[model samples]
Target: MLRKIYIILVHTIRVLAKKVGLLSLLESRRDRQSLLYVRSLFSIYDVDDMVQLDLPWWTFAAAAYVENFLRSKNGEANVFEYGPGASTVWLAKRARQVAFVEHDGDFAAVLRRLTEGVYNVSGVLIPPEINPRQALVAPSGRVGYENCDFENYVAAIRDAGGPFDMIVIDGRARNACLKEAVKHVKPNGIILFDNSRRERYRLAIEQVGFSPLRFPGLAPALPYLEETTILTRGGT
Candidate 1:
């Protein structure tokens, strides 16, 4: 089909561009537009300085939706994020409380610095349980992937004191995160799953009976489109 060919061609072009350093150029241009669009969408004009710094993480669409959602809240919503990065700071600035789980100590340290002096933000580093010889596969049969600390990661999130108003599953073992999130998320709360284009994740979302509001498109600084799905209980 023409659509399939187009997708392949686009992917190939992006791969080639990255090899030649042109991808960065394209992303820089795309990021400016992304920032303007997200700012307009969220009515967050004071974050121009933060947007310009180019800290990598969170798609623009995802951030915009989150910012707008938080803005609509009562200013006392607690947030739990499976990954920590720019989103940690973003949530810290908006939410009354933010808790994030990171798998790397060094990254956690840096995130702490980024969120320092922000009393509402907290990061927990739960390193992966590293099983060098073990291979983990998704339900889609994708192989050669592993998240050794996945079980522990889920436990950490559950034990972190929830019913969170919002949960962002953008880190490792996201399917497991989704499963655990069902219990900890408050009624009518939202769960955001980044890169929901994966078949395994899609299936998991369906299995969990979430009514998903899907935002599928290009994210900030990325050369490709991905799905960022927001799931809510009772199909709301």
Candidate 2:
């Protein structure tokens, strides 16, 4: 009941922000630029329905930061992502190759449909080994899906054949994914970790020895502020 109320309250605030120009007052200059870039590409769609959106619903600052990195690469970087969503579609258009792993079959099928024509993208579905409905923190200190194991899901990126230039950890068992990400990403690779505001995620990220550049600001279709961190692998 409290979660529902929080959701409603946040939604109401976001709507108010949009209607009353509150975004301008709250956003920094960099955040405003990022929001503009997001609108330029995805102004027509609602991101609440992730399967329906054609662009990544990441925080405006993070999304724009990534778009710039991809552009700088000139479509030559190989990218891997843990969660496949509009980011898959967005990446397919920019990267040399895009591979991802998803735990949700229904969402994976929708993603497959969306990227069917894009030959640069491929993904494998590795559903939870046990209960998909329950939640429990696994023994490895990874939270979420307590009843199931994601050992295989976290390791599946290795099968994607990378040494990838970029990896986005935006799925379940993210701390575990971050550990695996360190192994597969190129020495100079970029790791995009969403929701870095979480303490557990921040703690895990720090232990991995990456230098993080955090973007804390608005995301597309979200009212409240959030954070997405871009970690440079092999940071001293």
Candidate 3:
């Protein structure tokens, strides 16, 4: 609540200052867009903070990537999303089938609540003690979750029964995130990797054997741009 107020106050001051032609004038288009995005974020919070079920830049970036892909692909396409970050629930809404895997128990609980009643979304809490492979063993009558390393697990998912039509990777584990994604996607399937600019995820994608398509430019009022990379499927 208070954070929203603070952002509003800051925005008002900046606007007035800009009008007076002072106080960090918005010289660059990037800066101008930031202010607008900040305002948009705060406004949603003011009206109903719950309007933001997911976190900021990451959530926005992730949603933008997937929405860009699935909004056109119409069909019962299988989507494998790693990491139950704030955006997982939103991804579920767009994909035909979505399975969310989370390493954190607490974060998983919160996400579970947010995802409740969201059709076609299933939440899995990755147990800590067990290895990533065993832990991933799909639950009783539920999908088995292998408590293996993320990369190996993703590869296994593909080799196991993958060749998915679309794969969205947003987890923080970037090194392995994109690599595993390639293994799962079917030829010609689209893969959207969030935060391409983050911690060298772009470079990571390059090493993973997929071609990434960069955006023309960042849109106005968007939190961050230089981070999203779209990879369209080509021949194997």
Top candidate on lDDT is 2
Q: Please provide, for model 1 over 134-203, each residue's C-alpha lDDT reduced to its tens digit, 9 standing for 90 to 100.
A: 5533211225334354567666877776899899888888888888888898887899998888887777
Ranking by lDDT: 2, 1, 3
**lDDT (CA) per prediction:** 0.70, 0.76, 0.54
lDDT of 3: 0.54
Q: Could you tell which candidate, 1 or 3, scores higher by TM-score? A: 1
Stretches of model 1 off by over 4 angstroms after superposition: 1-56, 132-147
RMSD for all candidates, in order, please.
7.9, 5.8, 9.1
* Error of model 3, residue 146, in angstroms: 22
lDDT of model 2 at residue 126? 89
| RMSD of model 3 against the true structure | 9.1
User: Which candidate should be chosen as best, given TM-score against the real structure?
Assistant: 2
- Candidate 3 lDDT over residue span 1-236, tens digit each: 87666667756765676578643333333235454444443333221222342332343444455566677667466676665544455556666777755656777777777777888767555443336434432221112433334433333344334567776665535456566667667787877675566554546777776777654334323333545566875541
lDDT of 1: 0.70
What TM-score does structure 1 among the candidates reach? 0.72
Residue 73 lDDT in model 1?
85
Residue 94 in model 2: shift from native, Å?
0.8
Model 3, position 231: C-alpha lDDT score: 81
Task: Give me the runs in candidate 2 sitting further than 4 Å from their true place.
Answer: 1-54, 131-144, 234-236
